[model samples]
Target: MSPFLINLALNFLFGSKGKEVIDLAQRLILAAENAGGSGEEKFRAVMTALSQYAQEHGLLANFPQPLREAIFRLVIEALVFLLSKQGLINTHKRAYYEQPTFPWA
Candidate 1:
């Protein structure tokens, strides 16, 4: 998904309290970079944060089923794009597009 859609999903997830989530996401991205993980790893780390936020907020229950599914998909797509841009994923080939093998996933 495009970054615009990702931003929209994030906004919806955070509601009017999105600042914390955005700050946390930024910090996590920086931490991932500092840890020297590949872009893919960093992206996965961000995804972990998203998952954690969802669980913590019980976001799924707060939304209708269809909206929840859409947000989930957007989050996943945003992560893929983030990883690809960071060169963590093998964008030159189609290899890393497989299901996330990360421990958290």
Candidate 2:
């Protein structure tokens, strides 16, 4: 997971684009919190919100479908790590808390 995340960060978040992705992540955290649900639900909400925002803003637009999904998954993992670290949510031991079915493209 760490390697995949590091790779994603390097691939998608270089130069000025890094700041934009960070800002998007911060907004995503707030959105998930406001979603007001159990840990899994809030986490799923983050991915859903991310998908919608990405589609609207053409984020990762040029990437292939598989690569785009991988990037989105890493983004969700990063967000979940943040949420868990801040004590805002707790995930089950299962890998990625059984990743929600969101539109990744």
Candidate 3:
């Protein structure tokens, strides 16, 4: 599930469609599984890894500042929703996802 979410995020975040995202997704899945502390901490670790990957790989280099930030936020929201669904987060946080308007609720 983490792999799927990472793949989705990679596609959305970078518009990349290839092996690189697969490799990155594997790493993310491992990181998410092995991440220590509570669920929130694990989530933060994943987010940190994602942000670092974006910066190091220049995923958002072509975008304007505001647009880049917005995209990043959406990516994070999607990630949270995905991870939560996988039981990596507390599901009680959200009732549903039918609207696709709010990431958590």
RMSD (Å) per prediction: 9.2, 8.4, 5.9
Lowest-sum lDDT 10-residue window in model 3: 90-99
Per-residue lDDT of candidate 2, residues 1-105 (tens digit): 364674476467685576676677777878787889687787678778887888989888888978987888887776666556545565554345445547494
Candidate 2: count of backbone clashes, pairs at least 3 residues apart or interchain: 0
Model 2 whole-model lDDT (C-alpha atoms): 0.71
Point to the candidate with the largest TM-score: 2
Which residue runs does candidate 3 get wrong by more than 4 Å? 1-16, 61-70, 79-105
Scored by lDDT, the top model is 2
In candidate 3, what are the lDDT values of residues 1-97, reduced to their tens digit?
5668766766887686646766655556667678987877766676667667788898988889678767766776775576566676555665553
- Give the deviation of candidate 3 from the true structure as CA RMSD: 5.9
Q: Is candidate 2 or candidate 3 better by lDDT?
A: 2
Model 1, range 36-69, lDDT digits (tens) per residue? 6676676566556665667777767778756865
What local lDDT score does residue 55 receive in model 1, on the 0 to 100 scale? 71
What are the clashing pairs of model 2?
A: none
